[model samples]
Target: MTPKIVIFDWDGTLIDSVDHIADSLHLAATELGFPALERDAYKDIIGLGIIEALQTLYPGLAMDEIQAIREGYGRYFFSKQTTPQNVFAGISELLAELAGANAQLAVATGKSRRGLARALESSGLGAHFAVTRCADETRSKPDPAMLMEIVEHFGIEPGEAVMIGDTIYDMDMAQRIGMPAIGVEWGVHPRARLEEFAPAAVASDMAALRQALYLA
Candidate 1:
C-alpha cells in the first residue's frame, strides 16, 4: 500500500548535485591547505550535516577549524548557479503525482536551513512539500530526530510514512523509527551500500522509484 506521508532526502536524491557538492568540498579543503581525499570520500559524506561530515572526514578539528571549513564550503557551494535545472528529470512530475494522490510530502535533509531554503526556491519545488526539517535545526541523519519531528508534525504513525533517499544514513534513521525506506541508486551511495540497511526497495530510476511508491 502507498504511504500517506512521503519524506525525501535533498542533495543526492532530488537533485543531481553530488558532483557539485564533492567538488566544492575538495575546493574548500584545498583552499585551507588541508589534505584532500579521493572524490568518493567527499561523496560518501553527502547525507551528513556539514559539521558532522567535516568531523568524519577530518577528525580532531578545533571549533575554529570546523567553522572555517564550513564557511569555505558554503562560499564555494553558493558561488555556483543552483537552478531548477539541477533537479533530476521526472522529480517534479513525481512530486505532483504524489501530491495529487493526497500524500503529505516533506523534506528531511542534512542541508542547513538557509541552504535548503535557497535550494527549494531555485529548484521550484518548495511548495510541493508540506514541511521541511534541516540538520541545523535538529539532530542529523541516522539519529532519527529530524525524521521523527517531521512524522510528528504530520501526526502520522511511522508505518504510514516512507523515506526515499540515496544514503545509508537515510535508511538507518528510518529503520530506527520503524519507518519504511526506499533507496535511489543515482545518488551518492551505491546499491550495495544501501542494501546493507535492508531498504523496502532500491530504485535505479525515477520510474522504478514511482513504482516502488505504488504510483506506477
Candidate 2:
C-alpha cells in the first residue's frame, strides 16, 4: 500500500462489541417501555454514531424518546461492561505492525470521544494512533468531512490515505473523496453490503485484512 496513513473504524472493525451494543439497546428499550424490536435490530446500526444509530433504530420516536434511549443505552452499556471489549484477532498485531512500518494509524469512528477514550485507555494502544476523529466531533460516517479533516491534519493528499472499516458508511465516506478503502467481513455489515459502496476489497478475516493494509 502506498498510502502513508491508515484510518480505522472502531466498534466492529477493531473490536467485537456489537453484541453488547445490541444488548444495551434492547435493555434500554425495555426499561423505557418502548416497543420491542426483532432480534439484532440494534446490530443493524452498529457503524453509526450513537445519535444517528438511535434515530435509525427508532425512526418514529420523538426527540425526547430518542434522548431517553440514548441515555438509557449508555447507562446500561457501561454498567454491564466491566471488562475491556474483546479485541478482534490479529488487531493488536496489525496496529503494532502498521506503526512499526512507519505508517500513521488513526481512528475515524462513530463512537463518541468519551467512548473512544475509554476503549483506547483500556486497550493500552492509544499511543499507537497519531490522531483520532469521533462522531461527536464531526459529521457521521458516509460524510467525507472527517476524512478530509484527517488528511488535512496530516498534510497529506487524499490519495495518500486509506480508510479501513466494516460498513458501507466508512466505504462511502472514503469513496466520496476518491480515496482507497478496505472493508473487513468480520463486522456488523456483510461483505456484500460493504461492497455496494465500492471498497477496494473486503477481507474475510484479519489475516486478509492485514494483507489488504499491506501490513502482513
**Candidate 1: misplaced stretches above 4 Å?**
none
Residue 134, model 1, lDDT: 92
TM-score, structure 1 vs. true: 0.98
Model number with the top TM-score: 1
Best candidate per lDDT, number? 1
Question: Each model's TM-score, in the order given?
Answer: 0.98, 0.94
The residue-by-residue lDDT of candidate 2 on 62-158, one tens digit each, is 8888888889988987775323448887788888888778899889999888888888887766888899999889998878888899999999998
Every model: Cα RMSD to truth: 0.7, 1.5
Per-residue alpha-carbon lDDT of candidate 1 for residues 185-208, written as tens digits (9 for 90 to 100): 999889999999889999999999
